[model samples]
Target: MATPAAASDWIRYWDEASSDYYYHRPATGETSWEQPDRWICGEGYDSSEDSARRSRAGSSLPLEDEDDVDAPEEDLFVVRASLSGPPPLPAGGPPPLSLGAPPPLPVAAAEPSSAQREERRRRVLGEILSTERTYVAALQTLEKVYMVPMRMVADAGAKVAIFSHADLDTVFLNLDVLLKLHARFLERLEQEEASGHFGAILSGAAKDIKGCYTRYISNYAQAEAHISALASKAPDKHRYLEVCKSHPDAGGLDVRSFLIQPIQRVPRYRLLLEELLAHTEPGHPDEADLREALARIREVAAFINEETRVLEKSLVRQGRAFVREGELTKVFLFSDLLVYGVPTGRGYVQKGQIPLGEGTRVERLPRTEHLTHGFAVVDGHGKGYTWHGESEAETGEWFEEVQRAVAILAMVARKTALEHFTAAKAGCTLIKFNHRDGRSSPRWVRISADGSAICWGDTKSKECKSMMALSKAVALMHGAKSAAFYRAQGAKKDRDWLCFSLLFRGRTLDFAATTAEGLFTWYLALAALVGPRSSEPILDEEALRARVAEMI
Candidate 1:
């Protein structure tokens, strides 16, 4: 047999062929191959115009290119025969026409280009987008799945407030603000990726976020108190708890943990931005703005960290029975206070709060009821409260946690006192002899190293007074010009005495150092803190160390 025409040659012939075309009308089993004006499928066309019109009406597919217009449209369907074999010879006529194999199925794109990997600030911005999406999801979970049901109960005139409606509202409101704001910022960041001006844009966005979080951070304590109140005092708290337990989204969550996520998210900016800054190259256009943003974000993070600590310490585990009250009372153990409340759906109706402090005491109570676990806490007032947990282990845990919280509060109170002194330039303590209110009798005084304040009570417990700022104290220290000012006067004077008088808060306060070296030690410490030559004026531990070294 003569060599069959190559497939390309047959396809070329079909490409140039006119209206005389044929197709296998599989449905009707008929072909009108003799009619030049009729498509082989029994669809007749007068001209290309008719075919084009029908194509537009969706009756037939339209030709993709003008070159295929003259080829009878039905002939395209005849090309579906497996291309594995050559087209048939068609009984000694020209090789049968065939449409090119159907275009290869399009390969789906990998991942969307918008979500592709990014670099530098752009990558961090993408992270921001991702985290913001997560934060919004969390907010939605709390608001819709948890708070919404509680709110519905409240609206129905349920006297028992399941949660602190006000606190949740505030948290939800602020969280929504952050969520929506971040979303907008994410959009801007994405849109401006190629602009290279995103440094300023990102800085502005960070500042706005910090600003928005300011209220939430500042009011964190109140929010924590409210949450504890609601969890403890809400008469319908169990109902709320039941709902939370049954919630598909919140079943495994601790309400406090879920609620604190938003609080925690605020401080995370520093970490995220620091990473972005670390990756950013020096002298880059965004470097300055990124640095500034990092500074501001760090400041805000520090503040938020402090507030977060308070919130964390205020956490309460409720629904435990009170041995004293003979019923279950919500127990909120805060850093500085322990509160008892009745649970309501809206919030806890606080029965009372006992200050937790150095004076407070926690002890295990005798487990009288086999069903109950017990502990006793003596608050700062020395008033005793006995409570029960579900088990011995549970009550022990409560005691430990409360004791730990109280210890932390004690440390914090001390630190706060020192911080107050540090701010006033009197952080360091110096043992000296002093007369109370200028009385003749001299007693050992712990003069604030900066001489800004004085304390003269027992070493175990002392009262501190903010006499003046360090600046004024410096002037007073210099203004008093007498060796006797550094030495005790009268017949009671001793060789080790170095006395000084400070006009503190318009009252003359006398101080006498024990020895010459001790006098200079006190002098140098105060001078380092309040003196004009002092580089580090705060007289903190490092400053005190440096000052003592100078005296040596």
Candidate 2:
């Protein structure tokens, strides 16, 4: 067994290395790869003719080293500065190069000694079987010592069942799913090992695990509610506790803790697969299967990340029931608001409303020696609601979900403020430029649709500001011409530069970008701002695409 720190290190290795994983959208029917050493700048870019030739040849751009195939998946968008820099060339031209076929695959490693590799594989299988057996034992303990006794007590006219049946159902359902899946896998794995057919079974391990994880995550919300209720709402739970505590087979463990074991075990698949991959050689028959499984399991982790993101946006599905202030409360979490409701004679009734914003705060409280899952939510007026969860996992989810929702609210507030400022000034588009109107050194300048451009000194110690009335301001892009900037050179004869001029009243402002793509973006944004409201100020497809591309 690894120490806690060692376990964390293993998980972090996969999490951080996931940057190399890229998902190809299915609809585009297009795929390409970019090497780290390549650049998008003029000197580093391939010629248009070469790009066209590659397209015609049906070849993908060189990808990262194939050895990284088992690395975790990457995000759809990467946030970083451009990798390209000024090329080593005289001002007039670039150096010649002979571009050829893509690089060959890396050489495979020398095979490990037979006995050592087989022993490692056997050890990995043993670990899997051991964990699976431990998990099965935990589930059996629940069914035998806990579930069976609870049913007996309920039959004897106790009110304990009323408050606990819903929770019991949830726990039993999820446990059943896990128990059957692992039991079958354990039998299959043992048989395969005996028959020396390990490759066949291991190949499909990831697909099977992926199916299980999908089901588990689907029931995550329900499981959380059930565990919370069991821990906090069970009436005279000491009766059931004494029953399980005194049982010979039971280890006197808290049932809530026992219930959370399966949830914790879900991520353990990644750890086990990592160990397996380390032992399997590149040429091993099971290597492809292991890689495929790793990728699929990584998808499961990715799904969790996305689900958390959606929770941050809003609780699209209704929130689960949580006991608050000694009553059942159903809380709906939205990016901008939280609505609390309680069961009433007629139906559920709204009990309170909390507007989450700049002033609202959600905090996780330090648990007491006895309570392991305490949290608090303080409204803008200082009114607070304290709550408890059944287990550490449940409590952590609540804390994170609320925090993410509040973060989304704060982000939306900032976005709204920016939009309002732009609307107040009747400006929609803005850009930064290096201005050399009169200063000896280039000054950083910000041009806005308010018919103005402000120039600031290198350290912003001095300022040059200009603005024009909306009625008189008009913006337009002009063709590139031979001109000397403060420090930049004039465009060469073969090169195309993007230059735009802003005219308002009697004053004029100029801006330039190095690439046509950027110039076109600025031109379109400015054109949209200056044009009449052909329809409305609401975001149409074009506006939405731009906003999503920029994120602000």
Candidate 3:
């Protein structure tokens, strides 16, 4: 046994039973089988004294002098075991050791070093290459077993009863293109991997990858629909597909299953690249390119998702309408949004979108001297927009669709609001709000857990500074802003727009939130306490208080 070298954190100990050397860090209570590099065996102490002590103890192990060792500093501390008991433990004693196996390292002490991170990055990159190869093989299987055979049969001028040439084109639309695109992509990835430049290859092929996948995914719905139709309507095609599943290359999957591979491939690439990027160091050469390639693939995947959402939405109506005098626009009424766009040579350029929600309003307007077939749409903020159509029937159709959409949206919103109110009433909801004075920091306001009272306090304080009984609160004036208030505070109208007031005991308390969602949650929780009159008659300060008091 030997004492730790001076100024070194590592303590070297000889285990007599196993005839092995072990190192321990007293501060972290970590034990390691490997000798720490910082331990200089005989630097701060007399080497001759140490050797004499070991000799007196009947130890046969030889201690190497620092001058005799020609090894580097990292290799200076070599493990030599002596048949001696363990070294004396420090003040509280060393952590218990089994000596049969190394102790589990503490999580805080086990952070991966730079070398470990680099190794992990290499492993993740290898995964990306391997998965891409497999994906390309799947695409090839689709083409060779399903696509090419159908085309060859059609070309032979035989009676193509299972599928028509037109059907083949629709079902296999752009799949060949996708196969070729991924095959080339896989080739490039392989070459880059071989060259030790795996991450740099994706940025160069982003354009082709995006374009091919975008085309393929957008038409994926039509292909799926065609397959579904054939499975139901044509038994012969179904039997043919059942037989195609038996092909060795088909891997026991039908045409539809193989068709879905291209759709899944882009997202797979995104996930693999994300994993690799996570392990890559910030300043590593491949970091920027990995990020860029990930962004491109993510963009393509997002486009496909948006297209899917649009396809799911039923188009209520779309036609030409005039928003202002001589400002004609193409308006599309979807299930949830009113999209107005300017018509271009190729298509429409989207100009704006109005979300249809609980507060939306649609009404018919009387014909004016300058405008005919008129209707008006009022948004959630009480702002009105007028649109005119060429004929009265067109205007009527638009008005009906807008009203139906608004009604449906309001119904859904009420259901959701009720659910939120129920939850807020059952449990505590906390929201932080900034004062309109702009000097005080934000404060945390919360409904009591029992749902009996509302309280306000500093952010970190455990106890509330002020409390008011929920039963005494008379009104919740939401969006209670005025021109005079903005002028007095020297603030813009949109600033603190989610401001509200709670009236209790003929006194008003003002609060404002940075986000609309926070305001809505507070409003719902308070409304659940005080009843529906909390939201009635959003008016000026004086009038709102009077109205709320009257309702009470």
Model 3 CA lDDT for position 88: 30
lDDT of 1 by residue, 69-98 (tens): 122222221232234533333243444433
TM-score for every candidate vs. truth? 0.38, 0.39, 0.40
All candidates in order of TM-score, best leading: 3, 2, 1
Deviation from native of the Cα of residue 357 in model 1, angstroms: 9.9
Residues 51-128, candidate 2: write the lDDT tens digits: 565567454432211221121111011211123322233333444222122122212212344565666776676666
Which candidate has the highest TM-score of all?
3
Clashes of each: 24, 2, 0
Residue 209 miss distance in model 1 (angstroms)? 1.5
Please identify which of the two predictions, 1 or 3, would achieve the higher TM-score against the true structure. 3
lDDT of 3 by residue, 382-421 (tens): 8888888888887787787677666645533321222344
Candidates, ranked, lDDT: 3, 1, 2
Off by over 4 Å in 2: 1-119, 151-167, 193-197, 203-206, 230-250, 305-323, 326-552
The RMSD (Cα, Å) of candidate 1 is: 36.6
lDDT of each model, Cα atoms only?
Answer: 0.47, 0.46, 0.57
